[model samples]
Target: DQQVKQNSPSLSVQEGRISILNCDYTNSMFDYFLWYKKYPAEGPTFLISISSIKDKNEDGRFTVFLNKSAKHLSLHIVPSQPGDSAVYFCAASHGGYQKVTFGTGTKLQVIP
Candidate 1:
């Protein structure tokens, strides 16, 4: 079972266009959510996160929204740039557990 699912393996968008990535979770115990952006061979950099208590979080050109009731989440990037081409991973954790489960990741390509 894919406890965490990122259905899309990749996405391509034109420069300055909007990019949207989707994720889903099956575990009901997850209470913390995080989105990490990664470049090839580099560590993932924290983008944005929202606890189960909140519905959304935004920073700079990135925004993440979570819906606890629906067990779904999404990431949106505005005015996408070529530099934004990278892999995005969705992760979740059960508050009491130290381990976090991650999605397979989605690769976003921004064409200039």
Candidate 2:
């Protein structure tokens, strides 16, 4: 069973709009949640992240929200641009160890 899951396989949004991606997890020990953006044939790059201690974290146009009780998290991209088009993966890990679980991924397409 996958500990992390991204229900949406893909999402489309117009340039300069908002894009929202959802994720869910089953592990209660997950203390850190992260969102990574990957381009075709390229390695995933870190995006926003949230700690279990906080309900939300934001950086520039990216924001991550975590709901511990619900074991849910979501990523919001404001004013989405074409450059933001990519596959986004949701990941989680408990502190200390290097074991990390990742969600399948959600492909976001920003149309001009």
| TM-score of each model, in listed order | 0.94, 0.96
CA lDDT, candidate 2, residue 101: 88
Q: How many backbone clashes does candidate 2 have?
A: 0
- Report the Cα lDDT for candidate 1: 0.93
Q: Tens digits of per-residue lDDT for model 2 on 38-95?
A: 9999998999889899999999999999989999999999999999999999999999
Tens-digit per-residue lDDT, 2-110, candidate 1: 8999999999999999999999999999999899999998999988888899998899998899988889999999989999999999999998456889999999999
Can you give the lDDT of residue 51 in candidate 2? Answer: 89
Worst 10 residues of 2 by lDDT: 93-102
What ranges in model 2 sit over 4 Å off?
none
Q: Please give the CA lDDT of all the candidate structures.
A: 0.93, 0.94
lDDT of 1 at 64: 90
Superposition error at 2 for model 1 (Å): 2.0
Model 2 RMSD in Å is 0.9
Model 2: per-residue Cα lDDT at residue 44: 86
